[model samples]
Target: MLVREIMTTRVVSVEPSSTVKDAALLMNRHNIGAVPVVDGGSVRGMLTDRDIVLRCVAENRDASTLKVSDICSHGAVTVSPSQNVSEAINLMATEQVRRLPVVDNGRIVGMLSFADIAREKAGMEIAEAISDISMP
Candidate 1:
């Protein structure tokens, strides 16, 4: 199956200039860990819960004071919505990242996660392989 087939269609994104606190609130509200940063319908970066905790909170930086761009992972690894699940899974493993921002025509389309992929199937082998590389 392709990414678009299983990926969440209702994506939640943030702006680069959005504050980390705002992002955090959104994540909390949506019960998500990361959000893609978009500008003019194009992806610029991604802000994960790890980024906020490690880059902002760990450094004594105020979440409300810091912008998503300040701590978001720039030049983020991405996958096309049309790509197959295995390919997306491979990209996540190779990049040592849990989440991938799906882009189409330079715009954010959706987001995929190792967890998302794992949850897509109940195969123990596939889940174990992906879970091994995923960070808590």
Candidate 2:
């Protein structure tokens, strides 16, 4: 199975200049934890709920004034839509990321989460990936 076979095609992303509050609201509305920060059809970074809480709220930065680029994790690790499911799982485990942006032609086309892997009937793979991600 390929990443495009299981990845969520309806990806919700934010612009680099978008406000942190806007990213948060988009996450809330989509019921997602992270949003890829994009610029000119290219992924620049990744902004997660934890980033907002730890980097903004805990640091006393105003979400309304802060840009997604300010709190987003730089150098996003991504996968190609044509990659195999095992390859995606390995990348996620090695990168300690629960979700990965699926790129095609330098543009984000979808998102693959651990849940997607689980749904693919790779129970053992998911468990191993989770363990790797949780390692200290």
Best by lDDT: 2
**All candidates: CA RMSD in angstroms?**
3.1, 4.2
Question: Per-residue alpha-carbon lDDT of model 2 for 28-128, expressed as tens digits?
Answer: 98777898999988999899989999999999999999999988999899999999999988999999988899999999999998877875766777757
Residue-wise C-alpha lDDT for candidate 1, range 11-85, written one tens digit per residue:
899999999999999989988777888888888888889999999999999988899999999888889999999
Q: Supply the global lDDT for candidate 1.
A: 0.86
- Candidate 2: misplaced stretches above 4 Å? 122-136
How accurate locally is residue 43 in candidate 2, as Cα lDDT from 0 to 100?
91
Ten contiguous residues minimizing lDDT sum, candidate 2: 127-136
User: CA shift at 110, candidate 2, in angstroms?
Assistant: 0.3
Identify the leading candidate in terms of TM-score: 2
